[model samples]
Target: MAEKQVQSRYAPDLMAGQVALVTGSGSGMGRATALEMASCGARLALFARRKEPLQETAEMIRAMGGEAFVVPGDTRDEKSVEAAMLKIKAHYGRLDVLVNNAGGQYIAAARDITNKGFEAVIRNNLIGSWQMTRAAADHFMFENGGSIVFVTAISTRTALTGFAHTVAARAGVTGLMKTLAAEWGEYGIRLNCVAPGTIKTEALGRYPIPPEKWHELNRSVLGRMGVAEDVAGTIVFLASRLGSFITGEDVYVDGGETLHMGHDARDMIHPDMFQGRQRGDGKNE
Candidate 1:
């Protein structure tokens, strides 16, 4: 797979001496973020399910004269995550940042979603991320102190009609980050989350989105769709020393999409808008 374009403004040594472990580094936002951090001089332990794609990421990092090691493992499995962490600790000798970016969920109406489908998404997005975070904390962050960033989806804020599974999973992840921030602060481990709005990626093609829907998504105040690099920049910032004081907060990098609803209207407001009878109070039929 070709490496995603990474346009960053951080200094070359912004992450010097830092060892970061990024799950799902094979492609998509994970690969983009990994490249950005490597550009900033962070040694990377790239984790993903497939070995070939992880090798591709490692090659890209090495091409830039940066250091990276591929740790191929499924994020949903605790044993896989534990092995990845052990390998990272052995390879890098220390872990400074953990980027929980490995997650997947298919779009389905809330009413149509089956128990098996919902559970799978939860395992991939919520439990997997938590396992990685806990492993990193127990393995290195507890003693060395570090930053942990969870790459969640903006659906947590503006809940999507068809993507209930992802919305719920990401919402849980945000809650986990908030609680971890409070509990892990004493150990000097800062925890935070980054929620990205709809962004252009290879995976976007898999979704059943039409061209007009894409256009509607682009009207997010900025009048454009977000690229992977936009999210990567924020991830690099949180992983670096620049965000030392920021913790337990979520940064929405969606071009102001979450701040305002879809599109603004100029229709006049009715005087009786607030005087409408309650729905179920036996008022207006």
Candidate 2:
């Protein structure tokens, strides 16, 4: 067989010499983004709470003749974030991009979510992203400058039932990105958020969403569920020179899901299905 041809919309060296750190890179959007960036010639620092998954991501990058460094740590912990940044600096000597993709939230109605549950989601999504962003800036981006992308949910565009906690947390991240972009623009640092709609990933399986109701999750203009690459492509664009002029923006990779938001929530959210579930028990969405 002829050697398989590889096709990419982006220049192979679009991100040459740049070092990017992607959290939650063990699988799903995180892994997809890392691989995409690597293909564009960006050295990767794979991070997540699990070492094995990070290693798996690193292996995939290596298989493609790309460079990858694994730095396993929890994004929600200040110390862990700091240590991960230090490790990335030691390994790559510089950082150019940071993708805050490490976050999770269980499906639960507002009334069923306890204060601890709410706080956990906030810490994981909002506070953890803040921590990673701050550490990256202090360690490398402050004077050198870089791009920061936060993976948020399109639910921020409209209220998402059974995901009140995540919507709130992701909304906070959106606000944080906007404010920081304004504050960091003088430093030549670009900050933005990528709010993805329901992307088909392993995390979706954890939700107990019935196969029949899965169609309801794709209530977007595209009339199809999104895949990780859908969001990963947008993120790579924002982090590359293509989006140098873009900042303080929340690009929706939702296939126009926001255009008809909440239309399917009634059919999808099964309160009973979420019963007994607590925060931190959810998988990455």
Q: What C-alpha lDDT does candidate 2 achieve relative to the native structure?
A: 0.89
Write one digit per residue (lDDT tens) for candidate 1, span 11-94: 999999999999998888999999999999899999999999889999999888889999999889999989988998789899
Off by over 4 Å in 2: 1-7, 261-285
TM-score of 1: 0.90
Return the top candidate by TM-score. Answer: 1
Q: How many angstroms is residue 22 displaced in model 1 relative to the true structure, after the best TM-score fit?
A: 0.8
Residue-level lDDT tens digits of model 2 in 76-170 = 88999899888887888999999999999998989999999999999999999999999999999998999999999888888889989999999
Task: Supply every candidate's count of residue pairs whose N, Cα or C atoms clash at under 3 angstroms.
Answer: 0, 0
Q: Can you list the residue pairs that collide in candidate 2?
A: none
Off by over 4 Å in 1: 1-7, 267-285
Q: Which candidate achieves the best lDDT against the true structure?
A: 2
**Cα lDDT, model 1, residue 116:** 95
Error of 2 at 126 (Å): 0.5
